[model samples]
Target: MPRLAQPAGSEDAQDPVALLGNLVKASILRYVRSHPGSTIRPICDALALVSTTVQPRLNELEAAGLVTSDPPWAEGTDRRGIVVRYSVNDEAVTDLYLRLGMALGEF
Candidate 1:
């Protein structure tokens, strides 16, 4: 058996199942991926989820480094924001996917 190559986000292990297994989290990620720089309301409207459900999970994802709320930190992103925008951390997502592939012995 091979060990995980690198950790994803804040977790000690690079476990994609733990990160993306939940339907809500998965959908949220997909939304953020396609709609980079989306605000909470858009996510809620698109997913048909409530603010309570989206906000906390977004916070969690941001904290985990799987998502980023800092638009200014990224290039070509809108800096003007009364409402914080969300985007998927592409590097982190790639790392997680690679980790998942490794775990499945596809790599």
Candidate 2:
């Protein structure tokens, strides 16, 4: 298994790469990567998952430093409130690829 670097002082200190092994997490990452600035509601609609389910996974990805979200005070906002748009961390994705290659002896 590949190890993903965790941010300092992260409460959920588990390996992020290991976390990506989960199908839901992987799908969430893929969706965010493609969508770039998508918010939770659309992700739920696209993935057919409820907010309660997707929100926690998004939180995990953010905590793991694999994804980033614009501040709630940013320009975009829904009727509910500030819509936090998420995007994948390109550096982290690159690191994940490198680590996976190394673990598979493909380096």
Candidate 3:
């Protein structure tokens, strides 16, 4: 297995790459869970990000098993575009988020 770099003060020797990957995944996961059946465009809008940036992050999160896309479908407009819906693996991502929040006094 490939090793990820550990985050600062991560005494567990967890790979940092994987940790950062999880953070990105968590962001997507949180957003998806909060807003299911949403498209990439709206997701980008909610995050204040551009499609270019959001799409790649979505793809990466999908590869990381944190998100899944829905089938291509048409919305109100006649134009055809993929309505990417996302679902998060709650157990993993939520636990991490909770821990981070507790650590940061946000919980």
Candidate 4:
């Protein structure tokens, strides 16, 4: 696998290849793209994964700005233990891929 050489701490977001290369991450991405407002449980059910797997991926995606979540607290739900909904940040994904293409040249 080809990779771009970069300085330390330069990876502000996820590596595009790493994100797409993993089966679980790719599936989560596709699912959120199709079902924009899906939460953890639904995503787990649809993908047949457990929360331990799904949650961290979602967190990574969120941290990388690939995915956005509207938590219940932010919406004034006042409900305890309400799971947040996940959605693809289309603009961010576009930016990520654009950078990836530039990095990998012929990618």
Best lDDT among the predictions, by candidate number: 1
Q: In candidate 1, how many Å is residue 22 off?
A: 0.2
TM-score of decoy 3:
0.57
Model 2's C-alpha root-mean-square deviation from the true structure amounts to 7.5
Off by over 4 Å in 2: 1-16, 72-80
Tell me how candidate 1 scores on lDDT. Answer: 0.80
Ranking by TM-score: 1, 2, 4, 3
In model 2, the Cα lDDT at residue 88 comes to 92
Q: Candidate 4 residues 1-107, lDDT tens each?
A: 43967656446434787666589988999999999999788999999999999887887787777899886223334634876889999998888788777665545
Ranked candidates, highest lDDT first: 1, 4, 2, 3
Q: Candidate 2 has what TM-score? A: 0.73
Clashes, model 1: 0
Which digits, one per residue and each the tens of the lDDT, describe model 1 over residues 26-67? 899999999998998999999999989987788767777899
Candidate 3, lDDT over the whole model: 0.60
> Cα lDDT of all candidates, in order?
0.80, 0.77, 0.60, 0.79
RMSD values for the candidates in order, in angstroms, are: 7.5, 7.5, 7.3, 5.7
Per-residue lDDT tens digits of candidate 2, residues 41-77? 8899989999888987887787778888886332343
Candidate 3 displacement at residue 32 in angstroms: 1.2
**How badly does each model clash, as a count of residue pairs?**
0, 0, 6, 0
lDDT of 3 by residue, 1-107 (tens): 53855457654323223544645445656688888777877777777778787776776665555565665322343424544566665665555556555655576
